[model samples]
Target: MSIMDASGLPATTPDSNQYSAIPTTPSFPPPSRRVSYVASPSLTSLASQLPSNLGRSRQVHDLVRALGLLQDEEQEGQGGRDGDEGRASSPPRATILPPLKVGRKEIGRFHDLDYVDALLSPKTVVSPTNSPTSSPSSSSQSSSDDEEESDSSSSPKRKRFKPDPTPTSNLSRKLLSLQKFGLLDDSPPFPSLAPYVLALAGAALRAAQSVKDGTSDVALCWDGGRHHGRREAASGFCYINDAVLVILSLLQQRISIPNPPLSDPQEEDDRPEKTRKPRILYLDFDVHHGDGVANAFLSPLSLPHPTSSTTTSTSSKPLPGTPQVVTLSIHHHAVGFFPSSSLSSLTAIDTPHPHTLSLPLQVGASASSLKRVWEDCVEKVRESWKPDWVVVCCGVDGMAGDGKGVWNLGASEEEGELGWCVRKVVDWKGGIRGKVLLGGGGYNHPNAARAFANFTSIALGRPPLDPRTPIPEEGIADEDWESFAPSFDLEVPVGNMRDLNSSDYLDDVCQTFAVLAERIRTI
Candidate 1:
């Protein structure tokens, strides 16, 4: 059914275009890669961050690893290759699905790729001397003369990326590629997620390749979820819109991002290439509407693509796909409940700034309601769009039994139907590139985290294991367990929020998009 082959990719080809403005970077000394999770008393036991909500989001990096979503090595080889049967002998994919090779130039490629270039050109290299000491490449203290030269070149260097192809036959390779990018440093709040999103985007492109190879079935791609971000502002603890970027990237690559999927193929493009961009069914299970992602796909009535600089040629061209990425969100909103930020977020909705968001008024529905809503908003897209790929953004907040969920998803003592709903949609038989990605988080709850872990297994067409809550040295005490049992369901009201009024601050942003969830399920 599957096979494993060991062949390195061809030497970096000459066609490797230079997206970054900076010239060949001298390998500078690396900076500290230490990531510290400074937990305050209010957020002590990462699990308790979100009340009946889900688990700590950061836990996903670890849990998925334990569950094998983020393995360093590939496994479960098909009879011969890593993916579905019959993969062509394409060159080994670039080891880094990472965002086009991040450097000063590639980091800021936004609505305007060229503008990003201006920022990253060697002439604009800014001094890292005062940059957020997150992760810095090594450049020692140069003499005063050198400092001046550095300053002359230092004008807030824009980060540039390289164009890399990915292999659709291999999922682990995709994951590894995704993680490598996850480690890069982008501008402010860009956090370490830029590379991750770039890698995920590259991975999505890889999966779409299957459509042409004639061996792929579905496309499943995902990336880190960074909700709480405003257009140009990374909020909700997410620095990069990895989930959205991956989908957009696939579409740009002309990977035929599936709009919505039908049980069978319908209209075929008689043009060159294939439809592997995946009929992307974006499902944001996170409590939020995934505003940044929403903005990327469809600009709200009020918001649209702003006048972008010419440098961003990537943005000018729709890559290679059109309407390839379709998105859907299931989260809590105060439709008519209060002050409407949806309308406010509209002022510049036409402008691309990440604040693009959509919300639902009420989320207190039970399983049936949730399922009906999901299908209404999403399933129909597949029928209409007929996307070749599917990307699922699994947010644990909506999982029943978690605290951050706006609705019970399952009341009357039920375990919740979120996972079941996901399974029902993803379990379609023998689809190529079928995949689900984990995203978003509130108060870190391991249960929510575990639910995500389970979803990854299910997305892979495997059953999930009941996750066990790890205990302390003496084992979790019965009394402690009982005390830890969540009693109330905490929900954020959808309307009259700060994000709507423009008078709002970051802490209350959750209401803007219900914790921003984006899930892409490719069929």
Candidate 2:
């Protein structure tokens, strides 16, 4: 069977080795404000800032740099003081970040104060000062607070709160803090990883703010889709649920002040009052379910009303945060999948909630099956909620040969899906136009990079790369790029995993979506 592009046209594979370098692309072009790339300077600067000594992936870093996605200093240059001519000439090496208050506010919107504080309070042992002398000089700091990681048994006991055994209580603060920030081997808190998570989240929030403010129409968070995290606990290597925060931040359209009893309390100052929440359609194309984001907006804390079969009377008042963002997840589903219970339950129901739509394709789902799912989902949402903003968790694990995925969608199909989704959002009839694309679980690092790069091409309205075109293994990066030279070659064939889904199963899915569509119209 011939592979189809997002536009329903035949996609011809190009020479694999030829990298399409956009020579005319400005360092940071003004027209590209249509799509913003949300990357934190800390991605490189804080490579060694992990308490466990674990850092950002060197492969992702090399691929990104090789693709010329890095923003130049001139684009982020700082203004000098009144009469300092010398300072004006000396450009700062750091990328100016959005305010900490803003990020805290956004995180607080989706997560409880206690959980947010738990993440923020942990201190990483590694700092820029402690960075190896041979490492490049960077502006990334270890932690905002100077409090170093310490053991109370050996060091002076810090001020302690009166005991309250509940996890939310102030008493649990110290223990939770220790669990998260302490040694990595113990309890798997991996508190040291919190900074990187926050950095990705903060960058996304900034991008969302910029979009809301009309500064940009599209935002790309290449490293910020840890979809499996829950409000209370981290799972699947995700500590803080950045995707949830991004949605909440965009919906609220303002930063909320963080006021917590679990840690050093901050004075509450409401600068940006909550605006009318936008109708959001969040699409998760990852192989695994985006349980964190799906549960966040669909839960009673956000959406109290369930999807109704009949329309509500006009006189009834809507619930707080009512008509919550509609989340659609299309992923491989089976009894053995990770975090299987809740997600699998969605498929069991004849009619699931409109807010939490799940298309759990059977294992070994093919490109054609995915396309059908996408078409049905897009049609249902368009006829029902008609979202004002689109957020996509663009994970490529479904690609053949993924470490964690079993489906067989290749680069062409993946790119096609993203391209189609973005184009639809951009062409929505209403004035509403915004999209935030996030990277999720793609374990095959090189393929992940290639997929992301191809998506970037689509986002920029550039021609799609020929799938056959080989990526030159040499001249990409130094030693790190060379190590993966074999994976970089264009000759690797993508296996076609045939669709194992039966016609009866597909009919049931269609019926479920139809029921969901009718249910959402009631809201």
Candidate 3:
């Protein structure tokens, strides 16, 4: 397949043998694995301009470029020849892909059509009926009254009403529509709304496509993991459900593999290879629970009890009717969290949908806490499910110093850090063929940039940058330079918050999942 750059034109392939001077550590999926990155100027510009994430996309793009990850082989060679001191050791070059153009049909796959229309249609009106006191007619009448009163007084000047650009009739209807679609406060419509939705959704779709087509073993779309988007409404600053759409797209394809070795040697020999639906694992590591995604795939069937003989399958094949998609969201949960959903609690395991799982961490969860959860719960589930595709939502909001987060996670390469978790997923061996890494919630713009840049290095099998690495000024604008003040480095060091996930809490988690793992094996 041909590679395209940000300009949408065909880009020349870089020489495969050229290597950078930067040293790299031996990690999972060696440097030879093909990794494709989905991005473009249009995507970043539109995404960064959003009110909630102002300048964040631009920050992430600039940092990744400053790190030299986006440089072509020719650029790297030229930099080395010129003795450019700022360039870091280059890892395997990732092919750049412009965001695809997603239309109403693609978006309608996950969102309600009427809601999509309200978002895309320029003529849609916002109704004034909801606020009668502020209606144009009332404002005009009020202005006339003011003018009459002023004329009677000593002041000769009269107040006049300024007309709205849109007609009152149309504006009122649009307002109502916006409210219906949940686009008023946090997710209000912006000037670049249409393009932002199209670009972000398209970026995610293209990433998933690259993996499904086997053009890339791993795909990265940093602008894509908007998990809180609902089927008919927007929530938690997420206007599009890109993660859900990606999972839906992947479920259509099928793959065949030999069954895993059975405990009984005779039974293993008798089993035959079978063709079945591709199983997808949607693993969310966002600070906030992925309620939209979990709700999307919540099935009606309950998990079979561990002691029930009827729940056990006689053969290695999936139970007669098991779901193809499984969602596991590890997030923070509290009584008054942003999203108040029963599904976000640990009690979800007791519900009917065993495939939809939630692992809620207490406040101030540190790397050690996450490491325990990974080793005990996540790994056990992976072994039992043996998923074909793993979609990871790498949200950095849980990292220390985030305004919205209380957890103390870091982005370094240490054993329980964010990079370590990503490395583990990239190297997974149980029938896994492709991986998709997506971006989610991160309020601290600079740290968000730092975390993703670090992840890109890990994804390319390159050496992890020192947390103290200086922030290069190459791509950042003069006006935005002050945002990186104080530290001016790429470090997101752990804070002083005490990790509340005690050993007892972790032990309970392990015991609970130990039984759930057995049930998954039978299914």
Candidate 4:
């Protein structure tokens, strides 16, 4: 929980900014183009880094291919039309930024150098006891020899423990990093995970940078939303918190940054539209609390006070010109969840915090409860925050029937929830502006693909589909993709989940909101 400098550089040196700032601007496609994304032929090379049978790597590969193919089709169709015709036929989406490969410096912005090295260069050391070359002591051997003759007739031979061939490179031992954090029990099939992690981070940075420069109002990085990463440790299947890095990238564009190579004033002058630091509102809709992101924004004793000092301190301390980043997570708060130890627990609600709100729901939470939380708590915070930029962690695990989730939000209702949340945040930022969409924890891969596709369309400002309209032919061209593409029309009905919002739970939610609102007001 160290405080990252506004520029996202290490805060150790007194004047590190002089040596670290780089005036790197993202290259984005034309705004009129259909959704700009971040996949490349290099994706195959990156996927090759891991074993073919690895589940997480396979998921990443599938998503990249699916999105790339979808974008190509959309662009081909849009290319045939011009100006008004094209505008009328196609949906509105932000320009796609060119694919970027983040180097060590970029990774260092949000992570420690030692941690980054650990992730990229892990080595397994074997002790003498575990090594095969070391033999038993002479005294033990002598003692055993006397008894060996009597026992030899009845005793069985034991097999020697042979160590597996050691991997000489970092790519082969990448899973060891996860094991180090206690998130994994053993090494996974995939060892070359660094490329995918870097790719996700690059995609998110591309989106945020594009938004900052005004070429693209929103950027979608469907692969990046690992919000459980800590500065030194990993948790909740997250190694690097790409969402935090994205915010830092966006903030760098607006903050009074130093050491711009002493020659890139033209880049600075080009962005006259930005007079002040942009306000950011981060929303996480995953079934787990965005504890890593919340940790980044925490300040000591910034929580609410029992006495009237809360109001007095607010009036006494001068508010900064730029608002602190505001984060709100709407997720399951059930006991003994996968991330039960983190702030995802219900007990987190009682603690005072600043610039963040965790709205955790009980098990079997229905669409109605979710709607109420969004309207009463999420909306209020958004209104007060009045963000100039918004980053959303859209995790589809909250949908009904997800194996890893307990929420009962049915298919249609879950889709509705995502659409509603996106529309609200987009409208808050003004249509087609200042939104960065990221993917997070969605274990149900098929349903996740379906949900993201629907949400992608929503980001493009498209209207809701009619129940009578047939499903797109491309949507179900192959059996492999059928899970991603529903057979029925987009309007297929799904009943509300079983309601678990008892009166007491509802009261707790209301009280939590009241306390949160008071705390935010002070900020």
Instruction: List TM-scores for all candidates, in order.
Output: 0.47, 0.68, 0.81, 0.70
Q: Write the per-residue lDDT of candidate 1 for residues 365-435, one digit (tens) a residue.
A: 45554554444444444444444455556665654455545554421111236566666556543332444
How much RMSD separates candidate 2 from the native structure?
A: 15.1
Clashing pairs in 2: 14-466, 14-469, 15-469, 16-468, 16-469, 16-470, 17-469, 17-470
Question: Once superposed on the true structure, which residue ranges of model 1 sit more than 4 Å away at CA?
Answer: 1-58, 64-223, 227-231, 255-279, 299-324, 335-363, 375-377, 400-404, 410-416, 429-436, 464-523
lDDT of each: 0.37, 0.56, 0.76, 0.56
Candidate 2 residues lying further than 4 Å off, grouped into runs, are 1-33, 45-58, 68-106, 122-191, 254-276, 301-311, 314-321, 347-352, 413-430, 472-475, 487-493
lDDT of 3 by residue, 75-134 (tens): 433321223443333345566667777899999998999888877876542234323234
Q: In model 3, which regions exceed 4 Å deviation? A: 1-30, 73-90, 124-172, 257-274, 308-311
Number of the top candidate by lDDT? 3
Candidate 1 lands at a TM-score of 0.47
lDDT of 3 at 333: 94
lDDT of 4: 0.56
Clash count for each candidate, listed in order shown: 127, 8, 15, 2
The predicted structure with the larger lDDT, 1 or 3, is 3
Q: lDDT tens string, model 2, 1-523?
A: 2233452222333211111121223232223225555553345333223332232333453454445433344443332122234433332111223312244556666666666666665543234433221122342322222233447587743322222344563324544454443212222443345565566566667767766776556666666777776776556656667778777766775333344344435756544444344678788888888887887767553221343334343543344546558888888777778757475444433333557778888877775676676677556765687667778888778877788888876665343344454444444555355777777877766677667766665565434455665564433434444445664542224575677877788777877787677656655
Q: What TM-score would you give candidate 3 relative to the actual structure?
A: 0.81
